[model samples]
Target: MEFFAVLIAWGAVQFWGSGAIVQSDDWFVALRRSLRKINGAVPRLLLTLSPLLLVALVLFLLGPILFGLPAFIISVVILLYSLGRGDFHIQLRLYLNSWQRGDLEGARRHGEYFDPELRTGAENALQLHQAVRKGVFYHGFERWFAVVFWFFLAGPVFALAYRLLFLIARHEDSEQRERDMAFQGLYYFEYLPARLLGFAFALIGHFDRCFPVWRQLSVAELPSDDYLDQLGATCLPGVSAEEAQDDSAFLQRASDELQAAQQMLSRSLLCWVGVMALIELF
Candidate 1:
């Protein structure tokens, strides 16, 4: 039943579009903002969130008792909410389109949506392009893979908890200390799942190159972005020497690589679904 719910949520997002599935004006953001206004320590803020989470969990737990076949509804609602409210691919497409048109300003604007630290004047075209790719890869994990991983690991409650922690961690205006603490918490939450996704990327894409990259990395030493970038790069087939040298050809090649990376992500997701199905069967 959980697996079926996962499929339904994934299908809705894929066909109906995430924008339709997740409302723009969600209470989660408001709740985060209200907590930010508390002017307390990070621990205090986290403590404040605890009861809210507890209430949500209680409600979800009661769902099965109160209604018939509640798993599907609860799972779909949580999954839809946990996934990115906006369209990641649309953002990527906007960046790529602006980039191909030689509109650096437009490209940088859209690219910063993925990577807030991106600076328009700081990096060259190739560097900026690579940064966008890395941003997309990591953001995809946060928005999709991480949420799904938690859902299967526990249920809707843990999935919601993971996303709440993510929101608190990634909130823009929070104090540096609070943001750091939240991000650290999120890092721990995602530690194992990121590795799993990286391994999946290896299997679905270029096994030989990606697997070694996956195997060689120590969790203590590597940050998530570096791990994702190195493994994702390995999975992609490189452009020809001529394509690399020419400016227009280079942009085209980069676009293709980005598309290929997206495809790899999709395949890895399907692989997860297959494994979960097998587990259910046995």
Candidate 2:
């Protein structure tokens, strides 16, 4: 039932993309604002999680209804809502189109939509695109892989909890202490799933290249984004500084790398779904 719920939710997202009907955080923002008026950390945290608690309570009540169909429907809805909040493919396409046209400035502007820090950190078009590549990989993991991992392991409740924590950690207006605590929670939650996704990358991508990096970073306390970036870099063909010295060559190479990253993400996701299906079968 959980597996079917996942399949349905995944299919819906792919078919419809992340339209406002399927994804929105405005309610969460409003809830957080109300919760912030509370007096203490414990109360605020509990209030922040109150939605998940309510969800769990409702699922519990619905578990015995109509052979759990109601619970299943709610699970799919929550999972859909829990997915990464944007149309990643569209964003990637816009960025790539800009890169392909030799519009470095336009590409950088598109990349900035993904990582505002790219504006300051990237020295050239190649560097900016590479940073965007890493950002893409990280977003793929966070928005899809991590959410699916929690959903499969625990159910929709934990998946929703993970998303809630992510929002708190990344929210600009969140209190410093609240953000810190949320980040800490996410660190622990994402640890295993991130490594597992890296392992999947190794299997479906350049195994000889990716495996060693995966093994080395397996036990490290590095954040998920950094860890996945390192693994993703290894999975792709290397680009030398000399190859990127010229404008045309650098843009082409960066475009190739971004395409490679997209393919790797797609393959890894298919691999994960296959593994999940096999697990359910046997």
Per-residue error at 23 for model 1, in Å? 4.4
Cα lDDT tens digits, model 2, 119-178, are 665776667866897798888898888999999989999999999999888887788888
Candidates in order have lDDT scores of 0.75, 0.86
TM for candidate 1 is 0.88
RMSD of 2: 1.5
Worst 10 residues of 2 by lDDT: 14-23
Candidate 1 versus truth, CA RMSD in Å, comes to 2.6
lDDT of 1 by residue, 1-282 (tens): 667767888888888667255644356556666676566666645763584477466656767674635645756777778776578888888988998897878888889977888853436767777888898788878878888888887776777777777676766656777777777877787888789888898898778777777888635456677778778888898566687668888888888888888888778878887888898788
The top-ranked prediction according to lDDT is 2
lDDT of 1: 0.75
